[model samples]
Target: MNLKPLKGQHHVSAITANAQKNYEFYTNTLGMRLVKKTVNQDDTSMYHLFYADERGNPGTDLTFFEIPNAGRTYRGTDSITCTFLRVPTDDSLLYWKKRLEDHGVSHEDIRKGGTRMVLFFEDFEGQLLALISDQGNGGVKGGSPWARSPVPQEHGIIGLGPVMLTVSDLGPTEEMLTEVMGFRKKGPYRLEVNGENTVHVYETGEGGNGAEIHIIERPDLAQQRPGRGSVHHVAFRVEDEEELRRWIQKLKEQRIASSGFVERYYFKSLYFREPNGILFELATDGPGFEGDEPFEHLGEKLALPPYFEGQREQIEARIKPLNTKSP
Candidate 1:
């Protein structure tokens, strides 16, 4: 594919059981801004919520589809086991540790991986997450501050960090990430999970917060069962629709089936599965969260696509009501 490397992660989509709880945990606890309030396009009965930094920037988004009846997620091979959010410094990491503890959110002690320090934790629904402190590694940069957030501006999360994928075998997946996709090998490190297993790190873009992917070679685990608390897919950033179309052509040449170009309202996207069966997406960064609403009123009310406008009453009636206002 001879294209420019991806400009870090665009967003990571996951599933959650309750809309209101998901709203509170991300907005109040983690201090992220609820940037978009909408329903799932395919299933209007469910809500699709987006939370991010102050501006709802491309790489800062972490979204969820609320499905109360969806069962717990089973972690295994060919799945994104953990999603990381980048904070600026070691002091910020300490601030988060204290914050999580005060909020009764359980988290592990800060652990070292190469030059980075990682603090692992999970959301209210058991969605695996980590807060990575890069300690001035040029890889992580730029974050907008949410002035209204309880979390002070100095320690607010920057954006999406490394996504950890567990694969049955590392060879094919690693090849796909490096050769087919334009990621460069960053190095490897040991993780203390199910004993000491080595994790190979690969990165794209400028190699910081939203640019890293960690692949853990777990050949013995079972295939993951998709449900609540599991990652639906991970998206990488491209410049624009032209670049996105180029990716579609490149994937076609590689004999990989893709969803062509999907108009996602906020961003255009192309979805495909990697060799290890994990869903991957290439998305453009334009027509962002501010496309429909003004920045001051973002996520203040339910926002629907033009197609869903006709059925707004029906959709709203089916989905649960949410309150994202600060306390």
Candidate 2:
């Protein structure tokens, strides 16, 4: 079977301390739609909150596992360092700078990086994030804007950008991205960290925010301690389950151990760790967030998978209540 390059990021999942706090930040502060409200399948006591653009498109999704007791994230090598969200233009960046400041969310001055300008910031839980100014790079094309968002449609966050991944050594992981995953090396750029670290860029498809990955080699750093505010996994997009099955078979042929095909209600997924021990997922793009509820009423109520439907009341009782009101 002939394999195709991944279209872009399907979603980036992270751990958060509280469901209500996360909901307020993403929906009120960031102005993203709370596309899905569900409980974690592995541990039914916690919530899996999905934030995305209006239609809940794959590349636009940013998700969190709400684990109130999970301690602060320990930053180190072999972890996803920062996630970039694309904005339409430099003016949009300026709008966001003021908006974040008004909300008391401290952010960095806009800085140039290769072909784009970026503004760095952190969430309430210290999860690293950035906003990249896009100059018609197709970042704004696929996503639908939330009509009820406080941010104006012209300046709203469009979709995912280059996700930064820190690795102790770049060679093996580089091979995994290029050879195994069909990404092309797009060269390197310098980033300000403890010191200046060279970050190599890789791309799939036509290469833009959604299709890019930034690899930072940091052998000097310690291994990551996974907890709240840390990225749990980065998922790449596949067209559908047919393509997903092909990827699974290919991983088997390549002797890379994977989670096999797992049904996620809205989408199917296959999980595995990269050479540097960072978790990765290949997820299908179809059977999206509208599967369980009407698009207009998404995230309005706690959604449970079919297996959990029988235990909805108990599961709901176990997890903390969330407020998904619009700001």
Candidate 3:
């Protein structure tokens, strides 16, 4: 059955053991807006925080689920290894290098990631990340940076860039991406990781920095043990609920088991694992973080869907307090 291809990267959700510190680093340090202050829909006992550009646009979102007492993440293959953010220019990389240094955040020198300049870095939890320069990039434009961001608007992150996934074998994963997911193979980039290797690039709608995924095959490594710093899932953008339903049907036709259609309050979603056991999500782009609160005061208070409203008292009493109000 013919279907519309996915637009691009939507959001990446990761695990964070300390919500307070996570907020400090992402908002105060990195200068991303705290778009939503809510709890994990499935597990309301814990917090699910969303950070993004000004309006909490789909492609800009980077979320986290707080799991207290979580263990350390063991780096290895078969993992969603790195998430990237897009900055305006090559000069932005230099600015970020200095900013990261001043914040005592460890980062690598600016270097080439594929054809674009990038600066690799880590968070307090050792979560791997990078900032990719959109110097000569086109297709899938980025989101608007928050004006109130401490990081100057010119140097602030605009949207998500390419995500890197490492797997033991590439055949099944590559086939799933091309045939079922409708991603086109862009090309490969050479790198020396464990040894000399090639990282395959794939893109979906309007192929560019925002719509690409870099896959590296590493049979030499074992499965990654995910903990506080590991990514939980990476979502691709579905235009609307209609498109999301179409995707659900397509997954069934392909005989790939999925979580079916899930109402996320803000947007609908469908969750499934790829051939390598890495979790993947398909989410709608609208009815976003603004649905519950005014755009000007987003993430200022705990927001919950109508279904969870009745249990708000119980939930709030159970979860620890973490203030996310903008000063």
Candidate 4:
């Protein structure tokens, strides 16, 4: 069946033990805009905070689900190990290194990752993250940084870059990504990771930093024990609900057991796990964060979807109050 390939990286969702600290790091320290403050649809007892570029664009979002007191993540195979953010130029990497130092954020000296320069770092909860310099890179374009971001526009993060996935076996995962999901192999790069030396690169739709997935084969390690700072899933972009429905149909044909169609209010989604058991989601790009709240006051208040509006008071009472208002 002929189908349109996924556009690129939509967003990366991870778990956080504390919403306040998560907000502080992604917004104040990293300088991303807090675009949405809502609860996890399935579990309204916790907060699902979204941070992105100026408009909460599809390729820019980095979200967290607050699971109060969640245990620490023990790194292993079969995990979405590291999430990369994009900086405009090679010089921006230097800017971020000093910025990370000033903020007391643990980071490594700039090093080369494939064709680009990357600076590795950890969040407050030890979420493995890196800033990749998009110097001379092209493909799916990055988003506009928030105008009021503390980090200067030239040095601020523009959008998400490549996501690192570590799995026990690479064959099934690679086949699922290529033949099933339409990702094209962009060749492999050598990186010594957990004793699993080579990392293969895959790219979909207008491939580039924003649309690549780097997979590492590490049969030696066990599955990760996920908790705080663990990535829950990574989503790829679909143009609209129509496109998302097509993707759902495609998954059904492949006999992949998926969540089918999930209405997220802001976007429609279809979730399924690949061979390695890593959750993957295909989500629509629109009916975005602005539907309930205006741009200027995006995440200031607890904005619930219409269906969840009735239980607003109860949801509010259960989840701790988080002040997401911009400074």
**Which lDDT tens digits does candidate 4 get at residues 1-327?**
778888999999999999998999999999999999999999999999999999899999999999998999999999999999999999999999999999999988898888889999999999999999999998999999999989999998999999999999999999999999999998788864445378899999999999999998989898999999999999999999988888889889989899999999999999999999999999999989999999988888988999999999899999888977674
User: TM-score of every model?
Assistant: 0.97, 0.97, 0.98, 0.98
lDDT of each: 0.88, 0.88, 0.93, 0.93
Report the lDDT tens digits of candidate 3 across residue range 156-272. Answer: 999999999999989999999999999999879885434567889999999899999999999999899999999999999999999999999999998999999999999999999
Least well predicted 10-residue stretch by lDDT in candidate 2: 136-145
Residues 1-327, model 2: lDDT tens digits: 599889989899999988888899898999998989998888898899999898789899999998888997788999999999988898889999999999999688888866788999899988989999887675325476688888898988888888999999999999999999999898788878546888899998767888999989989999989888899999999999999999999999999999999999889999999999999999998899887899889999999878789998899888878878666
Predicted structure 4: lDDT: 0.93
Question: Candidate 4, clashing residue pairs?
Answer: none
TM-score of candidate 4 to 2 decimals? 0.98
Badly placed stretches (over 4 Å) of model 3 are: 192-196
Candidate 4, superposed: residue stretches over 4 Å from native: 193-196
lDDT of each residue in 1-327, candidate 1, tens digit only:
568889888999999989898999998899998989998887889989998888889889999998889998877888999999988789999999999999999799998865689899989988889998857677646568588888998898878988999999899998999889989997788898545889899988788656889989988899999888899999999999999999999999999899998988888999999999999999999889887899888898999988779998888888778887863
- Weakest 10 consecutive residues of candidate 3 by summed lDDT: 190-199
Show model 1 residue runs off by greater than 4 Å. none
Clashes of each: 1, 0, 0, 0
Misplaced by over 4 Å in model 2 are 138-140
